[model samples]
Each structure stands twice: as structure tokens, then as C-alpha cells.
Target: MNQFNKTINRLGTYCTQWDFVKDRFGKDDVLPFTISDMDISTSPEILLALQKRVDHGIFGYTRWNHPDFKNAIISWYQKRFDCPIQDSWIAYTPSVIYGIVKVLSVYNPQKKPICFITPCYDGFMKILSSNDYPTKTVHQSLDNGVYNLDWNELETALSQSKVFLLCNPNNPNGYVWSVEDLTKIIELCKKHKVIIVSDDIHMDFVYKPALFTPIIKVAQKMDYLDNVVIITSSAKTFNLSSLGGAYIICPNITKLAEYVYLLGNKDSLSSAPALFITSLITGYTQSEAWTDELIEYCHQNLIFVKEYLEKHLPTLSVTIPEGTYFAWVDCSKLGIPMSEIQDKLLNIGKVAIMDGDRYEESAPFLRMIIACPRSKVEDGLKRLVKSLL
Candidate 1:
């Protein structure tokens, strides 16, 4: 078996995905495929680096200004995406959402409403609402099992909003944006004078024939770099979320200063922990092979689910994601209400999956995370089949 197929117990680690599912749903026997984090362990190189840091046993105020740290990030982007990024363009934040909220608050001085492509990462909606920021959603249209951006609706929304939050390799449906698609979005945002803040945390998980194009690259190509910002992290790629380190890449130096000033004022945002820095450096510098293997495993899992559904449940539909480890399955044809389908999955099927409504307008769909051991994926599918069929 590959390293990914090994079932590692995460129950006692205070894991939100496994440990809190029972408390959240009041069910102890539920198998959760809800949270976005992977069940697999992180890279061994990162673990070793972290252990070395622990051995030093000195925890104090740290700075992320080291050349090695910045170079690791720069080298990764250059090697993987063929994009040249300057060290000065990079800044640190606690997480991708933190950087986004900061950008939304500081950059939008006029307080124009923000817009995002719908069926997005649910956290974006929560963060926007919590900040009381007005929002407009551009819903993607599904055709032939793929999700396509509605440029007409998007332009209308962009005209009304000052900032557009883009989720490349879109969540729920996981369609990696094409260069052409991104070029169109850049043109639209540039025309409307809207700032583009792209959350590209899943940039590393893209599958073949579906490339992950950084919005900043598009901005640079169009000489509209000042109008764009990118929020990303190794957290999603290497399971380093709890480490709480993310990078905000701003090509425009003036806007970069604003972000630095705003984050500098917050005492909590002083610097990332040394462990996080170590893990990040190791992840970018030494974990490429591990990430490639993980992506292949996830792709196979996606194929497994699609084939299983086609064979056993012909009436149901599953969207094979171009990126990310999620399988968005449509349950509309099951003849059950969305709420009831969610209930049956939890109560009868004993599996916990995210309802489509959480991402956008309510729909008869469920998003299942397949970034776990093959056995677990098989188990979850069997339970889903038993309950729905």
C-alpha cells in the first residue's frame, strides 16, 4: 500500500474534522467527509525539520525576513508555475482568510460591496458576513459535468463591487481556471476598476489538462499588476493549517506597504512561529515529490468515486473535479429534499458530508472530501450507496 493508504488515527489530536463531528451533529458513529483538511500525514521532511526546531527548544519573537524563507517561496513559484515573484512582493499573515479580510478592510476605503464566484469556499461567505461587508455572488453555470464562469453575470457584479474575491480551482465543483478564463476576468475587473483578491490555496492540487493560473501572472501580463493580490499558503498543500502561516503576494509596492502597515499594527500579527516557518520552508523546498504522489492518490480517489457511482447509482450525478480532493455529488434525483438527504446521510448512512447550500444557494448536492485512505473512501461510498439507493 502507498503511504496515503495508511489510516492514521486523528481522533485524539483535537482535530476539527474527526474529533468534533460527533459533538457538532450529536452522533458518535458518523464518518465525516466534510472538512477540507486531508487525513494523510504531512511530509516527512517537514516533520523532521519541525522536530529539529523543537530540539532547539527556544521559542521567542521571530521574524520572517530571512532570505532562505523568501527564496524558498520564490523558487517554488518559479519552478512549479513558471512565474517570477520578487521577495519584496511577499508578506506574511496568519492564514489566507486573515490576509483577505485585512485586504478587504484596508484596501476598500470607499467600502464598495465585495463580490465572489458562488459555490465558493463557505468560509469566504462567513468572513464577509461577519465583517458586515455587502456581497454580490456570481453563480457558475454547470454544463456537461463542468462548471463554467458566467462572464455576463460576473461583469454585472464586478460593475457593482469594488473588490472581486476569486477562488481559482473553485471549491465544491473544482474547475481549474484556464488562462483564457482568467484573462477575461482580468479584463473585466480592470475595466470596472475593481481590485482582484484571489484565494489560491488550492493551486498545488490541480490535475492534468487543467492548469492553475495565478491571477497575479495574468495581472502582470496585462500590466494591471497593481490591481491584483494573491492569498495562498502551504497549509492546504501540506496539512499545515494549525501552523497558521500564509503568504500574501502583492506586486504593487504601494498596496504592499498598506498591508504591511495594517498587519504591523496588530500585535498578534508580529511574526509567524518558528515551527511554521520551518515547516513552510521544508514543504516548499523538499516536499515536491510527496505532493506529486499525494495529488496522484487524490486523483485516483476521485476516479474511484465516479466509477462507483456510475456502476451502483446510475440516477445520481458526480462532478469529477479538475483539482482539489472533493467530489461534488448531485442528489437531486434521489427524490428527497436537500435537508432530508443531509439528514439521511448523517442519521442513516452514518456519513457526514457538506451540503451544497453551505457553499451557495441551496441545491441537492453534497461535497465529499476524498483525501483519505482508500479504505475510508470505500467505506464512505458504501454507506452513501446503502442509504441513498
Candidate 2:
């Protein structure tokens, strides 16, 4: 049997996806396809590693600067994305967003605003709003279903921005950025002298034939290495999010030291996670096959969603994402307002999925997390169809 075929229940586990569905959708009974985390179990090899750490039973204050763990990340990037980095470029943060926030702490947003292509991750919006940071929202041109960068607009935004916060394999839509796009973006940022802070947490989920061009590679190629900061986590790929580990890859030696000193001394969040480090060691060394199998499973899952939606609810379109195990579903063909659609999905269908509005999209779409067992995918699709019909 396929490993993905195995089922597990997360209810009563206090999982935000299951136990606290009401906190998001305001309905306790709805089946949630909302959170980005997978409902399926993670790699067995990773589980074993965590179990071994648990058996050791000495969970004291830990450090993250060992070469073994750093080399694990380096090797994975080299093998997976053909991206190379050294131990000096790595720094530890508890989460990707935390690393971004730390980077932001060093720059003044008032002089030049942060710029990013929208419909972007809502977390980006929240961070800007909370901090009162100036920002420029570059709108990507949506053609048929895919989103393409508007170079002229992007250039304009970059001119006035200090930083470009990039979401590779952009959330809510899973558009794996092409090499050309990465090159052009690096060129623009270089031209404007703007720093790029790339959050590539979804790099592993990129589908085949559509490559995930790590921005760091482009930066290195363009000799713009010092201006780029690569922030990513193993949490998403290994389902080790609850383990709380993330790292930053800053090639600028001076800035890398600054991040370590500040995030460690000032922020007090630079300590390593014992289990998270162990999982990375074992998962990276042992779970290559498991991850490959997962990618194939998720690729097929994305296909199944598109096919099922087409067959049952023709008007509801699912944009076949080039990466990530998410379905960017469009219900605009129904001509129903987004609010009404959201209401029906919650109140009537009892299917809780995230609305695109969360990602600041103008379209009435739902970003469904399809990285679960096939049964849940079908169940959510049926419920969604029931809502509209």
C-alpha cells in the first residue's frame, strides 16, 4: 500500500487544522481544508529520529551551530535545487516568519517601502500592517489561470522599495517561479539596490517539469549574493512544523553575523530544537525516497482534485498549480459573491476552506489544502459541490 494511503486522526490533538477549526471558520462542525500543513503522517524515518531523541530524555537548552546539521541543509539544497552554500551563511530561527521579522528589524521601511508581487501571502500583509511598514504591492497579470510578473510594474515598485519579500512557489496559488523570472527579479532588485528576502519553505513541494528556481542561485549568478537572504524551514516538507526549527541563508558574512548576534542576544529565540535537528539529520540522510514518494502522491492528488471538480462542478475551476499540494479553486464562474460563497461553504456545505481574500486576491477563489489522504480530498470536493448546487 502507498504510504500516503495510511490514515490518521488528528482530532482532540489540539491541531489548529482539526481541533480548532472553529477558530478559523467560526464553525465547529465543518471539515477543514484550510491550513497549509498536511493532515497525513510525515516520513517514518523522521518519526524514528524523533523517537530516538525522546528516548535520550535530556531536553536541555540546545545550540544550533554544529556543522553536521548545517551540512545536511547544504547537501539537500545542492542535491534538490543544485544550490550551494557554506556553513558561514546559515543562522537558526524558530520559524521562517521570525527570520524575516529579524531581517526587517535591521532596515528602515520609511525611507523605502517593501515590495512584493500580489496576491501575496496574508502573513506578509499582516506583518507590514502590524509594524506600519511602508509597502508597494505589485500586481501580477493573471492570464487564464496562471499568474505572470508585470516587469514594468515590478521595476517601478522595486525603484521605490528597500526590500522585496518573495514567496517562491507563492502561497495560495503554488506558481513555481521560473528561472527566467528569477533572473529578471534579481536584475531588477540589483538595479534598484533592493534587498531580496526569499521565503522558500515550499521549495520541496515543487512539481516535476516545473522547476523551483531558488533565488539564492540567481543572486549568486548575478554577483548579487550579498543582497539576498534565503529563509526556509524543514517544517513544511517533513511535517516537522510543530518541532519549531527554521534557518536563514545569508551570503553576506557581515549581515549573517548581525542576524546571529541580534536574533540570539536581543530576540532570545536563536536556540536550536533538539528533535528538529535530529529529524533533519535523519530525514535528509534517510528519507529521500519518502519525500520523492510524497511529491508523486501530492502531484496525483492535485490532478484528482482538478478532475473531480471538473466532473462534479464544472463551473468551479481548480488551477493546476505547478508546485505545492494546494488547489487554487475558482468559483467565479457561478457569479456568486465571494462572501455568499464563503457563507454557503461554511453554513451549508460544512466544508471549511480558506478564501482567496485571505491572500488579498480580488477573485472569489478558495485555496484548498490537498495534501491529505485521497478520501479527504474527495469528501471535501463533494461538500464544496454541494454548497454551490
Give the root-mean-square deviation of each candidate in angstroms. 1.2, 1.2
Name the lDDT of candidate 2. 0.86
Query: What TM-score would every model get versus the actual structure?
Result: 0.97, 0.98
Candidate 2's displacement at residue 16, Å, is 0.3
Candidate 1 segments whose C-alpha is farther than 4 A from its true place: none
Instruction: Please give, for residues 1-389, the per-residue lDDT of candidate 2 as tens digits.
Output: 88797778999888999999998988899999988899888799888878888999999988889988889988998888898888899888888888888787665435458998787788898888788778998776455676776789889988998999999988878888888888988898888889999989998998879988888888888999989998998888888888898999999898888788888888787778888889887877788899999999999999999999889899988778898878988888899899999899998889999988889889787889989999899899889989998
Instruction: State the lDDT of candidate 1 residue by residue for 1-389, as single tens digits.
Output: 79999999999999989999976567868998978999999999999999989999998988987788899999899888999999999998888998999988777976789999888899998999898889999888565586767789989999999999989888878878889888998899989999999999999989887778888887898988988999999998999888788989998888888888888785458677888899989999999999999999999999999999999987788878888889988777788898778787887889998888888946578889999999999999999988788
CA lDDT, candidate 1, residue 164: 92
> Which candidate should be chosen as best, given lDDT against the real structure?
1
TM-score of 1: 0.97
